[model samples]
Target: MKSVHLTEGRPLAVILRFTLPLFLGNMFMQLYNLVDTVIVGRFLGENALAAVGSTGTIIFLVQGLATGLTTGFTVLTAQHFGAMDPKGTRRSASNALMLSFGVILILTFFSTLFMHRILLIMNTPAEIYDDAYRYIIVICAGLFSIVLYTLGSSLLTAVGNSRLPLVFLMVGAVCNIALDLLFIPGFGMGTEGAAYATVISQVIAALVAAVYIGRKMPDLRPYRDFWRLDRGMAIRQIRVGVPMALQFGITASGTMVLQTAVNTFGPTAVAAFTAASKMSTLLTQGFAALGQSMAAYGGQNYGAARPDRIRSGVKAAMQIDVAYAALISILILLLLHPLMRLFFPAGTDTGKLMEFARPYIYFSMSCYIPLGMIFIFRNIMQGCGYGFLPMMGGVVELVARVIPAAVSMRLGSYLLAAACDASAWLTAGLFTAFAYHFYVIGRIEQRIRRGRARMDASPPAPKKE
Candidate 1:
């Protein structure tokens, strides 16, 4: 029942402490992909690497839904916990688990059944198509493991226990690396081996998290009559969860469109895009963590009916985000060459690869501030129960991204395509920020004014009668 209540203390210090664990956890989550890319690229060669890389956006398309759903579900748990209502927290947690089961089945079924067609739709290169099919199918089939883990970790995070998830993720990541080495080299399982390793590791993490919750965090455990459904409760969760999931799905669709454009350029370009993107993902974990911190922080404060704290938390978080973005931007620019080298073999001709990838890495790193803003405002707004606005931001991003990528294709300019992400981030960040100001900020102010008015109107007690 010991939870890190973010409803009190200095905003900066508390956010920093919360964000550090979340940051490391985010990096470890990204580590799963980094290890796969490194092992596949180095040991299996370019075609196998490109094959795995090509599945990135599609994987995001599926996993993103799981992430968004879990995140949205837990926002309620965070709120209940913040309001010091254990019964509400437990009920919400149970409903989230039940909801996750239905989603897992549906996602796994569709992703597996239409695996080949999804790849075909993405315009996957014929040479690498078979390998891509094999790799993605395993991930799709084991989609339940990923969803289960996401739900567990998100619940823990909801109650302000980001550290435990990080520990569990570390265990899973290490196990994943060992399995990747064994299956890929020791047993010659090829690209699919990497997929198996990832799924198995996720199962391990999910199981560990469940056991820990059972033993330590009894308050977070499902109700005794877990099967009983509360229609109103489920409806409320769906109201929040569905829009958040759609936001992720919409954003991912844009990436999928961009990936298809990259695919049209052939496997070599695909590999370059993959390598650069892995690095970009790795470097941005800090920003992602800040966004997560804001969600938990905002939710808890909102539940505690402290709009003032939420405002201050956002200010502190933005400061941290801007500073970190500036530092990481400089570091990535300096280390771009060496980092890019890790994705390819020593003797391979990397000139052509860098030719395509350099622009992407450079452009993305240059726009880190906008990217960071997108994470911060969108998440904090969702935490404040304004899900639809963020989803609208995602639609803006989709339009911005798709238009540039398609135009780049028409002009046969990969460089212009590389600018797509920057444009999307800039547009989405602006949209979300404006939404927060126009909608969320006003709402918070109204709540604050009502609380003040209620206090002013209260009957005064007789003085020391």
Candidate 2:
């Protein structure tokens, strides 16, 4: 139940402490997806796996946009918390909830309406389209829960309440897995069953998160006026949220483009890539958690006007990023065989599938340090309430993926996949770092120096201890 006020703690220690539950929570979250994949792949077969996988990018597009908007709420809340302004924090939360619901309603309505067309635009395989359509529509139809759950999680984490979300997700994961078993194979529900399980679990988690905030964090409970729109705060909220949403959307679009190319390679290729992508996602969860923690950490310090803490926290985060990349790279290499065989049906071509996906894992492992950096640099800039450069970093990622993916598809799917992802990560990482260095670091230092000089010029207050 202990939550960190990161501005007052050792930068490295607090970040690591904060990141641990986030890491665990992300694992469970990824496990939620993995369970669905394993169930569908094992129960229904490769085509079903492809069907489920085919929707991943589109889901990310919608869900990522929701997450980005939620992050705007989180950054504001954390800033107010750091500054010891509970009323502002509560109001921010109220505003976030109201704004987010409007966004989610829009997303749910439109995405559900156009789900099939979007799938067609992605050039989904005809044989798998029915199954994919069933799953995507079910999921998108329930997109309201998805956005709510994600926003709830982000809100909780912003207050340094990472464990609550983790606990919720752990229960959700269990619920999801059990339901996956029952719905997929037990009842012969197939892809639709898996989608149902996901949506149901998310609703449970979101409900818990929503209720917990009201009960446990009374000060963070909004007053009636907090629910009414404040023009200035709403503008600030949208200002931060929109660019971040665009960043997620643009980056997801790049992956959507890659997904289209993967579809062209056949169902077998689709299945292999799906498994590998899941593995890559699972492996890098820690790094992503680190990024989220950094955003919270830096945002708190930024609100407290402590540039020194932000700098130190980011440095510590990058060090941890390196350690994580190295460890995960080795693990991926060591367990490649057994891991690859786990997702496929008993009689499927596990060997061929693993081999086909090998280059992606290998290349991704090699470039993970940079991938980790992208999460840090971009989110740190986001933490500081600066989004333009970070949004541009996402554009760089889009171009990096698109050119290689478009030009290299004829060479081989594996090579193209590897190049596309690796190039995107490296390019985005470099651009963000440059932006942080040039735009953020100097200005923060100047503020810190000016504050220090003013304090030096003024007479010190007498201690009354």
Candidate 3:
């Protein structure tokens, strides 16, 4: 049991070891999403699938916020782990858990209370509103499990241990798929059944991860020293977490705006967008897993004061991301229709809707490298305890989505909805590029300069001479 996942002294090995499990874990998580849709579409019909689709934006918003908090926890854990301070790591982990639980509770309460209102505001179709409301409410009610799982997993990833979480997620995903089949098809529970299955799976993941950490990861077990809340640590965690939360919230709000634009085009467009987005997510998971690897690798090394190794890790990540994105983009473009049909099925309006969505899918796929670069850069910044620039990237995404969406709706063209997405990626790419150069690269240079200055300012060793 090596204490830190990153041996700053060997950056590539650390990244590969940490990333492999994260990649598999993310794939399993995506399977959870795919299975939910498959169960709903196959068993409950298209309308039930639409109902689940209706709540996607809202769920992203809430889940994104929870994940942002988890990012803060990861940052703290990564830094402490890098510095070889187990006590500090434990304290940060405890505070992050407390903070995450509290935040999820508030989000769950309000989201459930305003479920109907939010759906209405999103212009969710009248036919699907009731089912959507039910689905969202159930999901919201189980927010604690979602938050806990994310928190625990982030802690593990932060400490360079992605395998434990990956194993637990695999178990949970299998259980979720079984439950989805049992509830939706066997029990005829429909959309509510899918939501219930998801929550149940999340709960299982959280419990399993928690037990594993408590038993295996001595650094994470809550002791009396860790139990005591330090005001300074709490403040630092919040300071880092809040902006990341806002970034996700803002980004999710833009997705809602895009959702509203899609809604105006009717259910066909909504269904198409939903299906396409799901496929895109599955593809992006490959790059995202790599990016997560970079975060842990970079953060630990940055903490360990190995700036050159951090730079090398980011470079390796960029190359991996670019190559992977290029391959994936080609595959997506070549197999668009067949792939879409698999998710949407034939002899249905979904297949036709997917045809309308082909252009959007192809265009978005072309930008995968840039999109991946953004993730790599953002995660590197996050690993280095810098959150504001990435938060600014969120602002860029929000404006790009909102303004284009508004214009497109006014123009009465659903095509603009896809355009807005591409534009947002382009805009976010610019910000990510700038941050990579100015913040990450610049910081590295500054550290080097300061080191030189200290040497120059040092007094002569005259006594030795």
Scored by lDDT, the top model is 1
Which has the higher TM-score value, candidate number 1 or candidate number 3?
A: 1
Model 2, residue pairs in steric clash: none
lDDT of 3 by residue, 44-81 (tens): 66667777887888999998888887777668778888
Model 2 accuracy (lDDT, Cα): 0.86
Q: Give the per-residue lDDT of model 1 (tens digit) for 140-178.
A: 898888888888888888888889989989989999999
- The TM-scores of all predictions, comma-separated, are 0.96, 0.95, 0.93
lDDT of 2 by residue, 192-296 (tens): 999999999988988888888778876467877777877788888888888899999999999998888888878988899899989999989998899899888
Instruction: Rank candidates by TM-score, best first.
Output: 1, 2, 3
Model 1 — which ten-residue stretch has the worst lDDT?
222-231
Clashing pairs in 1: none
Pick the TM-score winner: 1
Off by over 4 Å in 2: 410-414, 447-465
Clashes of each: 0, 0, 0
